[model samples]
Target: MKNFDIVTLTVNPSLDKSTSFRGLVPEQKIQCKNPRFDAGGGGINVSKAIARLGGESLCVFTSGGDTGKQLEALVQKEGIETHAIAVKNATRENLIALDLNTNSQYRFGFSGETLSEPEQQQILEAVSGLKTKYLVASGSLTQGMPPEFYQRIAAIAKASGIKFIADTSGEALQKTLETGVYLLKPNVGELAKLVGVEKIHADEADDAARTLIDKGQAEIVVVSLGPQGAVLVTKDITEFVPAPNVPKKSTVGAGDSMVGGMVWALSEGKPLQEVIRWGVACGSAATMNEGTQLFKADDARRLFEWLGRK
Candidate 1:
């Protein structure tokens, strides 16, 4: 296997198909445009975002059936190197449709195929055998899979001295924290859940993130505040950067783009402040595109430059 500075894992991947229609009338036969297909999931989107930034990472995912084959083809089209593990069940598909009249986007997602016990073990074996500086595990666990799956991977990464970064929510995210990670990217709501709070206001974002860091759950906690921007918290550093206003588009891959930007920056030896800025820049830039498309390199660069002056 070839070596890479960053490695991303997507246990439950999807083939995302997007289209637009004139209006959303009840039970009407709405005429829709041709659908756009993209290989989507947390880790895969991260790899694609890294590629958009002129960087490379090994994308490891599960592949099965015709949908899986098509997903692999789409990832190849993006020019990302991948290591796909075959499975018995087909990969899931998701739909995203835009209502032109209301400018609203509706997303429909299906449950992923459950992984067999043996298949689950294969995933662990693959992660244990990898050689990389960063191991990023993202997305939701499939049906019937243990919530501690990511935590197990975190343990493997720890034993191998690989920096683990996780982007997930709910029980899976909670379990992974038990094993600890190098970094965690959680939205405001998810962060609130982690710290046992009902909500985390903007003024309390830093302390909320610090609660996790203080418990040794993570070395760095980056709380994404959406339009308000993001906050990066560590034991010694707490920097809050406001988001730059931009035109609205689809937000399908914004969070993954942020993770991709931060990991790429960390790999390049950038400072923590600049790393958070790059993350916010890429995330904001991702919303400038339609459907499941990530940010353009030019837009990200422009946003990064603008953010530097703030």
Candidate 2:
């Protein structure tokens, strides 16, 4: 178990299988290209992105059965240190198919197998035992896990004086906010929902994020605006980083890439402005690659330099 300053937790990990098809027609045998497999889950993908940036982090995830073994192998292939907890149920697999004709990506995600109470407790204990500076709890809560599961991790991070960065949605995210977090990366729509609004226009992003910061839900709130770029809001500072225009390929892991870039930059002691720029650069770079592949180191560096000129 190599020591790391950053630790990522992924309770519901997946093996992502991606492919491309010429056309999408109903019921006919459609020819598909060879599939590409990658280890996926919000936290795992984040670790992959960090690895791409020449950074290291300890990736903690649940593993079971053959699928879990494959997922572990894939993560290890990325050169990420991992701590996998054994479980009885098999891990889930997701499908990402690109329609070449329409340039549309169809993603089919499956629910992860339910974990027993003891299994869930084991995950909690593993997280509690970690000695790190930053603890990132990302991804969704599986069916068997309680909504407060992330909140429990947040409590542990707080008690240990570790900075907690959370990227999740719905009730799980909502509950985690109750315990407060060091940072939050939520898309515009998710930010709207957290602020009790149906939707938020681009101009309203900063204020909406401010609402959460004012509530002490999170110290920093990063609202991702997709193509328009991202905005970072803290108690006294707000900065927006526009996304660099680039040829789009697949958006499968863009958000996770953004989190990874920001976390890696933060670990390096970069300023908040540079942090958000790294996030947007990595996220934009990720869209240039197909399937679950994250950004290339050269690509991210190029984009970051380009952004610095702005």
Candidate 3:
């Protein structure tokens, strides 16, 4: 196996197919344009984002059947290194349809097939054998896979002193927090659920994140506030970076792009503040593109520079 500074694991990878249609009708057939395919799922997208920023990370994912094969080819086309473990079931694919009439994007997602106990063990063994500094585990666990799966990965990362960065939701997020992590990015609603709240307001975002940091759930907590921007909370500091205004298109992989930028910046020895800027910059830039294509390097650099002035 090749050496890498960062490694991303996506237990439920997908083949994302996107298309546009004139309008959505209740029971009538609608004419749709040709579909576009993209390799999706959290960790794969983060790898794609890092590659877009001229950084490299090894992408580890479970793949099976023809869809899985196609997903690997699409990811390779983006110049990302991959280590795909074969599974017993075919990989899942998601649909992104743009209704031109209302300009609203509708996303249909399906859960990936469950991984057997042996297969889950294989993933753990693979990560244990990896030589890396950062271990990024993102996306949802497949059906039948326990929520504590990420917590197990967290243990491995902690024992090896590898910085663990997690981007997930619900029980998975809660369980991972129990093991502690280097960083965690959760949206307002997701954060609220973790902290046992009905909801978290934008103004209260920092305080909410601080709660997690103070509890040792995470050393750094980044709460994404959608179009408003994001708040970076740590033991000593709480900073909010406003998101750059850009032409909105699709938000398919914006969060993944953010993680990619922040991780890449961190790998480059940038400060935490600058790292968060890169994250917001890349995430905002990703919204300027269609489907799951992510962002252009030039656009991200432009946004980063613009954000610095603000």
Question: Candidate 3 clashing pairs?
Answer: none
lDDT of 1 by residue, 1-310 (tens): 6799999999999999999999888887999999999999999999998998889999999999999999999998989999999999999999999988888999999879999999999999999999999999989899899999999999999999999999988999999999999999998899989999999898898999898998999999999999999999999999888899999789999999999999999999999999999999999999999899889999999999999998
Relative to the true structure, how large is the alpha-carbon lDDT of every model? Answer: 0.94, 0.94, 0.94
**Tens digits of lDDT, candidate 3, 264-286:** 99999999989999999999999
Error of 2 at 167 (Å): 0.4
Candidate 1: misplaced stretches above 4 Å? none
State the weakest 10-residue window (summed lDDT) of model 3.
237-246
Q: Give the candidate number with the greatest lDDT.
A: 1
For model 1, give the RMSD to the true fold.
0.7
The superposed Cα distance between candidate 1 and the true structure at residue 25, in angstroms, equals: 1.3
- Cα lDDT for residue 238, model 3? 86
